[model samples]
Target: MSMTVNPASVVDEGEFTVRRTIRIDAPLEKVWAAVTQPELISRWFGITRFTGASGAARVGALGTITWPEREPVPVRVEAVDAPHRVSYRWCNPCLGEPVPTEIDEAHSTVFTFTLEPVTDGTQLTVVETGFETTSDPAADLESHRGGWDGELDKLVALLESGS
Candidate 1:
């Protein structure tokens, strides 16, 4: 049987945030690499290109995420804690408009991934915030809510398959 994981999202204080937790049957380091590394990221998420000095998801790093037929979504790394956590601010480009090369706070959101070691593997929680600043907060939140549901499941499958 397939696993079932549900994410929670809320709109409060003018900001929209969605939080999802998944228990991956993989080691913490492996899961961390899958999320932060560009090569591994392409397997489940979009094609990620980090334009930072180290090409790792470090603070101040600028990058773009391009899907099959979509514009390259711009992103800037905001925080990092090695195998534990990483955060970035990116525009909600899933709305189908031209992807901005730079992020504007009023139109961007922050996505944070936090990991914890569990008995079986790792418990990964992703929290995306800062939607209130966007022009279409509710629509953006809804778009990402659906996006994460599929993307996170792909991540889980990727790790579980040992790819």
Candidate 2:
């Protein structure tokens, strides 16, 4: 079955926020697994091709994101509250070949993913900031918008599947 997250469910909005809240038919830990675990992450989002032998997740925990032509984006855990919240910054994040835009001029951006519990399930919010673009604004926005939408959809599917 296809997963769905209604835009109306968005509780708050920020100028820099990408996805406000994604309610999943799963528990906080389940959602967290989908977000953190390398194997589960790959199963859901197709982002992690493989993982280090360390095999653990903790604050300041480092990992790689599998994107071809792009180096594995090293990630450092900024904040962790168990199955509640997970905030991290992507190290040397390749924001898709700087589009000659002001935002692209910036060295990198900060990506934070938060999780909250709701009556239905877990409410997930992913906020990516520091995208201050001038030229090629459309390209930058379009790429991010499409990418997040697709990724969020995948999260829903993965969570619902009980995988």
Instruction: Name the best candidate (by TM-score).
Output: 1
Candidate 2 — which residues are off by over 4 angstroms? 8-15, 49-56, 68-71, 91-106, 133-138
Spell out the clash pairs found in candidate 1: none
Q: Could you say which candidate leads in lDDT?
A: 1
lDDT of 1 by residue, 43-130 (tens): 9999998884454577888888888878888888899999899998988565557777788877789999999999978999888998
Candidate 1 residue 25 C-alpha distance from true site, Å: 0.5
Q: Model 2 Cα RMSD, Å? A: 4.9
Task: For candidate 1, give the lDDT of residue 136.
Answer: 70
lDDT of 1 at 24: 87
* Error at 49, model 1, angstroms: 0.4
Instruction: Kindly report the root-mean-square deviation of model 1 from the true structure over all alpha carbons.
Output: 2.1
Per-residue lDDT of 42 in model 2 = 69
Cα lDDT tens digits for candidate 2, 1-163:
6566545222112353344566898888788877767777766554553234344356766566655465555555667777777765553433654322122224444556788888968888887654453234444445566667777887788778776
